[model samples]
Target chain A: MKKIIYLDNAATTEIHPDVLNEMLPFFKKMYGNPSSIYSLAKSSKRGINLARERVAKALNASTKEIYFTSGGTESDNWAIKGIAFANEKKGKHIITSCIEHHAVLHTCEYLTKYGFEITYLPVSEKGIIDVKELERAIRKDTTLVSIMFANNEIGTIQPIKEIGEIAKKNNIYFHTDAVQAIGNVSIDVEKLNIDLLSLSAHKINGPKGIGALYIREGVNISSMIHGGMQEFGRRAGTENVAGIIGLGKAIELSTNDITRKTGYLKELRDYTIDEIVKRIPDTIVNGDRVKRLANNINICFKYIEGESILLMLDHEGICASSGSACTSGSLEPSHVLLAIGLPHEIAHGSLRLTLSKNNSKEEIDYVIERLTAIVKNLRELSPLNK
Target chain B: MEEYSKEVIEHFLNPRNVGEIKDADGVGEVGNPVCGDIMRMYIKVKKDIITDVKFLTFGCGAAVATSSMVTEMIKGKSLEKAEEITNINVAEALGGLPPIKMHCSNLAQQCVKAAILDYRKKHEK
Candidate 1:
């Protein structure tokens, strides 16, 4: 059997066994609609409620504030559009960072057609947004400030609490797309003064297509999906029962011992980063040295494109991702890397290897071995190497 | 990788005629690194017949595979015949690249043509 080493946890994670076990009954025997008022429906309703509670607990939010969505994309769309439309009367301006995930950036772009002014704050060379710049970007009509808790590509953790504080002082609602931050970084919505936040289950060893949005009680955001009374009438459609259950169990397991889980992941991440930089010449470790996700190791190899490296790695039973334009399905390199001031050529050579608890020291060593050879070989085949 | 044809993956994994011809009669370079693909082709022509061809590329799988395939396609062919080879021919020879990767084939064809053009320019002078 081929030995597969899955390292793209930020893209999505393998479901935890415990989460899968908890969700099994919901998909088979206890398959009842949560909206249906019957005894069988009680199990489904209980499952959703528990998942919502788990999500709320992780963010230090109240159960009433949590509303399940399809996933991070939907949650991001809901939060950004909901806040933008609802507060249009108050103000038509929104502030966000340049390095946010496409989920937030595209949503902000879409809002532009509706005459909602947006300020995309630039990040420093290390991909950290300037808090003072964010403060200055805020206008009197800036009704909301939306920034991602962490970047999906480079894994740079933004100063969300500082942004949240600025938004609070300016009397603007703050929303954070925390899809990549869940389980990786500890966040408390209350302490951060975050009015709206988006998170997904798939990033933390849970099922895909299940996520939650946290909305402060007094915040007046309009519902994104409407037709059914599910999710307190904020979101509509039949609940993803099994997914919700898996998310509940996954969140509980991941957050129960966050310190230990992150500590172990950090050791692996740092080791991998250090080894790659040391072993390979002309290799750069992207993102901040610290204040980044514990599991992320983004690097750019000089003189070779990323997809070729990814292909070679894939051949060796390794799974990873890249910020190269060829892999992006669009012919543009990662905006995050570009925003951080990397040249287009270097950005094209970017590789993102996001780790998980399942990864180990041995796997990292093997990856270093294979990666060193791949980089050396590809550089030999590169025209720019001359 | 699934989007790539088996031929593309095969060619990419074992790219042929890689590296440069140090003292080649003609050398051509095309495409930009900004677009994530840059291909350089070197050709050695003897008595109006292509004697040897090699390429070096900095790009994705498609770019490398296409460069490899084009070099193989034009290696022993006459300059006139190699000049007739289009991007379509290169892509077809590799069982077709994805629409997004068609540019790689174009880069390959352009690179070969650029080398041929260089050969012709030197001789024409």
Candidate 2:
């Protein structure tokens, strides 16, 4: 039997015990449709409303501002397309960064097909987009500016507050996809002046298939899903009662533990970075060192392919993700790595190791011990070993 | 969880003929850095026969497996016989590869042909 040490927390997280415990009754004894016309439905509706209030409280927003959706992807799609279509008469221009999740990028691209103009803001070598460059890119016809609060691949934390201030000065709506940053960092929607925000439960040790989109009060945005009057007719679907309960519990727990967990993760991340760079030669760490997420450690090894390293890591029962396209079905290097000025070959050698509160120093040491040997073995068999 | 075939994992665990032949008669290197698969093949030819072959590959399990299998398939065979090996043949020889990983076998096959071409160019007297 292999001792599994999972580190791909950015992709998804193991559900917390408290979250699972909260959701079981909804799946078994308390099974009732939130939209039903019976007293049995009271608990279901109460559960969803509690989840919404919890999500809203996490972002310092009003309860009415939080609307539950399927997940981050759906929220992102709705925010971009909903705002673009709703404000088409005002302007058809949108703004985003080059390192957004595909939910945002693809939605922007989808709108471009329908005659919507978008300007993708470029980033620095450390993966931080320039505020002045953003201000310059904004035109009178720009309707919205959507930027990620923290990047998923490189883990760069953009200046969302400053970007929001710029948008407010121009009276453009500001939306941020904070899926990766929600539990790992502190966020105050009121302080940041964020108009719209997207978050997923699974990223914070909650159940999957449930998320929330925070819309500021009185924002006249159009709806994307239009079947039932669920989600206040914004997104059309019967509410996921079990998943919502899980999310609320998960959010409550993670918010309380954020300070201690993030502090520990940052220490571990920095230690890992220091050790890898010191022990391994020709390594480049991606993302801004100070402004990056506490749990993300993205590094590139020269002359070694990431898929080979990942395969070898799997043999050692270590789970991580690679930016290389060979393992994934994509045919190009990670766009985030490339956007940060990495050469194509260097980008192919990148690895992302995201952590969680469950991780320990012993696990980190075990990874370091195995990774050193694995990199040596792969580099020996690599064609780039010149 | 286990996306790789048993044969692919076996070959990757213990790759054969992995090294560069210093002062080799012919060498071929091919890869697209964007896709992160690279192959370097070295061959020793005599009397139009491939007396020895070696491959160094930087890629996934499929790439390492295909390289090992391709080298084992072509050693001591005539250059003409070795040139007939294709990506499909290498994949079939190792049970099979996922559709996305077919390019790994393609890299092996292309490297063999490329090494032969390099051998022919140098000997065109």
Candidate 3:
């Protein structure tokens, strides 16, 4: 088999060896349930507590503020629905950006059925929301503002601090789905005035089924899962001890030297973007270059569909993702791309290559070379090519 | 990505009849870029038979493979016989496409029929 070049790190990452090692003990010797009263279960409880503490420390929050859940999608569902349900009496209005993940957008859409009015603020062509627009969208009855930390498709980071301040001044709860930004971007919940934040472990080289939501100490959010006393009675489920331990270790390792890790990824990302643009004709870079994630590169090649490019790249052992309608199950192009004012044709040709620290310069170089050839060959076969 | 048949992958990686015939007797174009797929078929007819056929397509693997397969299937056939070819035949020739991509085969069939129609329209005068 050919050696693989995995460029779809944003989708999910390989579990770190250290994280796996930490999790293995939980599955074997420490198999007792944390909810059990037996002495054997004490170790499991300790493991969960330590994991919570690590997650809290990464975001500069108290241990009590973090609650474990299934993954980013659940965290998002819980955060948005929790705040919406708890404060509906105060206001039935919620404000969020149009470019959020389906996890958040769908939740907001669901609320409309319950008599809640949601305002989806628009973004600029670069995929950044206008702070003034968000402020203007806020209403007297607005109880929550949910925006994503960074876009998963285009890697555009939002003005989180500004949004947080606006939410704070309006006395509205601020929730951000930080699934894509957690390990790469340093976040301080208190400093940023964030009321709630969501993150997933899988994106940071941890286990797939575990994630956390940080709720500020005084937030009045209702329980998303109603069951036994777990996650301070806010989220109820049997503790995923092994997954928790893995998340703890992964977060610690990723955040311990985030500056260096992000700097290294930024270099590779810049090199990849510059090489692709220089070698290819009519290639348009997506998102804000300066405000984008360090590891993401989204580009559009004119006159060709993204799925063909991805298929040819896969033949070369390079894994990437695209926003083309043909690739996604839905017939429409990516909502995130469309929200940024991209025409449907241009959106269908977009390619996203999210890097990881483990990827090497040699791998990127080979990808650039193959990508240039693939684009050229596809253009030759494209009827739209002139 | 959805799993594709080995034949589909084979044809996509090395699509056949992948260019245009500048002086072709008939041309057919179908689909739009907004839909993430488009195909243009060109044919050179001699004595009411398709002596040569080629295609250019911008789409996913399925779309390109279907266009390639249609061109190969009709190269030596008469215009009326080529018009008789259906999307199902095109799909079966390619071993079968995923259910969602069945439309890509339809695009190929429509393109070929359009080309044949174009050929007939030219000779009607």
Candidate 4:
């Protein structure tokens, strides 16, 4: 097998060895349920509590406010649906940006059927939303506002602080899907004035099935799941003890070491961006250079299609994703790219390279070399090529 | 990145006969940017034989590979023989594309048929 250079960290990260080690004990000796009253279950309960504390501490929120769920999608659904259903009679209006993940946007769309009005906030060509526009979109009937902290596709980080402030001043609840931003950036829920924030473990080099939703204390949230008394009866499922321990370890390590990790990723990301621009003509970077995530590089090579670029890269053992889901079941390009006013051809050709702290300079250089050749070859093959 | 044959990957990376044919007798363009796959074909014909074929395709790896393969198959063949060039033969020629890409794979054959039809409409007079 060829050596692999994994740059598609946005899809998911490999579980950290430390996180995996912390979780190993739970599956064997500490297998008792946290909900059970037996003495054997105390270790599992302690593991869950420690994880809750770690997640809460990472966001500067109280332990009581952290609620665990399946993953980013579940947390997003719970936050949007929880607020919408809870305040249905007060006001059916909900506002979310058009560039959000399907988790948030789809949830808002689902609410539209329940007589809940949804307003999709548009982003600029650089994928930034104006604070004033968000303020104007707020209405008396608006129950909640959900905008992602950073986009998964373009890596555009929205003005979450401003949006949160606007939501607060209007007395509306604000939820942010920070699935892509949480580990890479330092986030304080109180500082950002966020009412609800979602983060997934796998995105931060932890286990896949566990995630947390930060609901500010005293925020009204209707439960998405019923029956079991777990998660304060908010998300009723048997606790994923091993996954929780892994998430806790992962969050604690990532946040404890975030400054260095992010800085390193940023250096590599900028270098690659510069190298690609210098080597390839007619290529344009997609998102705001400075405002974008430190680990993300979305660049569009003119005339060539994204899937072809990805395929050539794969043949070289370099893995990345087209920001567009074009090759998949959805023929349409990425909504995030389209929302940013990219034409269909440009959007269709967008390639996203999300980095990880583990990526070395050598790997980055090899990727650039292979990628430059691939782009040139594809462009030559493209009819629209210059 | 499903398991594509070496031939498909080969043509995708190094496709043959790219670009447009200036003042070509017949032209066919198929697919939309929305669908994320588009193939434009230009053919030069003489005495009922396709003298030369060229194509410009903007699509996934399979689309480009299929387009290249179809052009190679029907380049010197007569219009009637070229009309029989199916996407299946293109796929088989390239050792098969991923099943999901089979839909966009047909864009090459469709464009070929359209171009031949275009030639017929123009020369029947």
Candidate 5:
């Protein structure tokens, strides 16, 4: 088998060895239910509590405020729909950005059909939502304001602190789908004035199928999923013991090594972007260069389809993704790219190469070399190319 | 990643005949802006036989590969026979496309038929 270099970290990450190690015992010897009262259950409860503490500490929140769920999508649904239904009496108005993940966007769309008015805040050409526009869009009955901490497609980091401040001033519950931002950047719920925060374990190298939502103390949220008395009855399902342990361990590792990793990834990401622009003419980077994720590089090759570039890159043993993996099978441009004012042709040409800690400078260089060759070849066949 | 069949990967990695022929005898473009994929096909037809065929696509790997394969499959065939190309045939030619990518091949076949109609329209005049 040929050696493949994986660079689509924004979509997901390889689980850290430390996290896997932490989760091992729970799968076998410590497989007791945390809800049970026996000695075996006591150890399971202890593990759950410790993991909760680590996760809460990472976000600067109380452990009691964190409710574990399936993953980002579930957490997002719980935060958006839960709040929408719970606070329907207050005001049926909700405001979210146009570039939110499908989880948030679709949830908001669902709410719209249920008599909940929704205003999609537009982002600037840089992909950051206009704060003043958000302020103006707030209504007396605005029950919730949900936006992503960072965009999954373009990697643009929004001004969550500012948005949170506005939501607080208006007495609206502020929620952010922080799936892409949790480990890549510092997130303090109190500092950012975040009311409800959604996180996914997989994005931070924990496990798949496990995530958590940080609900500020005193926030009103109805249960989206109901079953047995698990997660303090906030979410009702038997706890995923191993996944929670892995998530806790992963969060701990991410928070501890974030500074060093951020620096390294930023250096590597910027280097790759710079080389791509210099080596390939008419290439443009999507999203704000400075405020974007440290490891995400989205570029448009002016006259070529991103899928073609990805295919060539795959043949060369490089793994990455287009702007929207869900829409990759279709020929339409990415909604995020189109929202940012890219022409349809250029938008179709978008390619995203998101990195991980495991990716080295040598790997980055190899990708750059392969990508340059691929772009040049694709452009050679492009009718729009001069 | 699912192990893409050797033929599919070959078409995807090195798509054949992927450029537009300037001043071609017929040209056809299809796809809506909402669908996110668009294909423009060009053909040089002589006495109802396609002497050369090429395409320009703005879409994913499946779309590009499908268009490339379409051009290759129809280049030496008569216009009437080229119209027989179907989405399934294009997909099967590449071993098999993911179910979701089937539309890409559909778009390619549509482009071929539309281009043939364009050729017929020109010749009848």
Candidate 6:
């Protein structure tokens, strides 16, 4: 059996052992509904409360402000449509960026049909939204501004604090999808003046199907899901006990080792980028170098498609992702790449290799070796190379 | 990752006949830039039989491997028989693709049919 080198951490990280350990009790021994009023349920409620507090402290918010959801998409939908529908009488205007995850973009699109006007701010070639442009786009009727803290594809970290301040000045509700940023970077909701925030556990080496939204106290956002009194009636579903437990443990572990692990990933990421660019010609790194995620490296080879590159890498036992996994089967280039000003040809050739603590320098070197050979071979056959 | 069949991994690791044929009898290209895959196929037909076939593909490993295998399968076969090659046949040639990567084999089959159509169009004219 060939040993596989897994590098596609951006899609989802392997669940940490500690997180799994923390969740095991909930799945078997401590199986009690938090909503139930019994001694067993008390412990479950306590676990949920403790997890909420840990998450809140991580974001510098109150535990009462946090409401759990399935994942980033659910949190995003609740924040956008929930706010838009609740405040429709006040204003029907919303603002977001072109590079936002489809969760936010598609929700906004749905709102547009209901008479809400959306202003999608454009990013520069490096995939950073202009704060000045955002300020100029804001009108008196603009009720909400939802921007992602970090882009999933390009890994560009936005100026969320500055954007939050602008939203504050304009007295608009600010929501940031921090699914990719939560464990990777420091986030102080109060410091950033963020009104609402979204996060997912899968991005931080936790189990999937568990996430949370931090809505500031007194925010007028309505619930998208209706059911029995759950999540303070804000998000209605039986609490995901095992998933939430794993998420809490994952966040705790991530926050504890964030500084050291981030430094390690940054070193490995830079080394990989340096090696790739040194060996390959006409390759451009996507996203801003300085203001990007520590784990993400998105690059576009001038004349080769990313799918081909990934396929060849797979054969070499190295795993990675193209710009958009959703469009991998289709022949179309990534919309995020197109939005960041890549030409259609270059966009099709984008590869995103995200790192994690599990990745090592030796693995990165092996990847570079295989990638170089594959690119050279594929480019030789590409008519566009000439 | 699941254990891939030996043939699938073989084609992926050592894809055969990958590249374009210059001045070919017929050419066919599929997949758009936005779609994240592009395959260009060239055919050299002699007396209504495909004497040689080659493919240049910019896609995932399965796509490149499928194209390579498709060309190898069609070479020396009559145009009518080559045109009958289906996605199932191409996938089976590799012992089977992942469910997600099956589309790549489908793309390869489409390219073959298209190339045959192009040959028929030119020869009839």
Q: How do the predictions measure up, each by TM-score? A: 0.99, 0.98, 0.99, 0.94, 0.93, 0.90
* Per-residue lDDT of model 1, residues B1-125, tens digit only: 34888999999999999877889999999998888888999899998889999999999999999999999999888989998999999999999989989998999999988998898898895
Screening candidate 4 with a backbone cut-off below 3 angstroms (N, C-alpha, C), the clashing residue pairs are: none
| Residue A147 CA displacement from its true place in model 5, Å | 1.8
Could you give candidate 4's per-residue lDDT for residues A257-330 as a string of tens digits? 78888889999999999999999998889989999899999998888789888888988999999965555457
Runs in model 2 with CA error above 4 Å?
Answer: none
Model 3, position A28: C-alpha lDDT score: 92
lDDT of 5 by residue, A271-373 (tens): 9999999998998888999999998999888777776777788778888888533244344567788889887767777789899888999998888888888
True contacts kept of each: 0.94, 0.77, 0.92, 0.71, 0.44, 0.56
Candidate 1 per-residue lDDT over residues A140-165, each given as its tens digit: 89998988898888889998888889
lDDT of each: 0.91, 0.90, 0.93, 0.89, 0.86, 0.86
Can you write out model 2's per-residue Cα lDDT over A88-130, one digit (the tens) per residue? 9998999999999989999999999999999999999999999
DockQ computed for model 2 against the true two-chain complex using alpha carbons: 0.70
Q: Flag the better candidate by DockQ, 4 or 5.
A: 4
Worst 10 residues of 4 chain A by lDDT: A323-332
Give the docking tier of candidate 4: medium
Clashing pairs in 2: none
TM-score of chain A of 2: 0.99
Report the TM-score of candidate 3, chain A only: 0.99
Give one digit per residue, the lDDT tens place, for model 3 in A254-341. 8898899999999999999999999999989999998999999999998999889899999999999999998888778899888888
Using Cα atoms, each model's DockQ against the true complex is: 0.84, 0.70, 0.85, 0.61, 0.44, 0.43
lDDT of 6 by residue, A342-368 (tens): 887888788899998888788888889
User: Model 5, residue B9: what's the lDDT?
Assistant: 70
Candidate 5, B71-94: lDDT as tens digits: 999989988899998999999988
The residue pairs in collision within model 1 are: none
User: C-alpha displacement of A66 in model 5, angstroms?
Assistant: 1.2
Better of 1 and 5 by DockQ: 1
TM-score of chain A of each: 0.99, 0.99, 0.99, 0.98, 0.98, 0.98
| CA lDDT, candidate 2, residue A344 | 85
User: Docking category for candidate 3?
Assistant: high
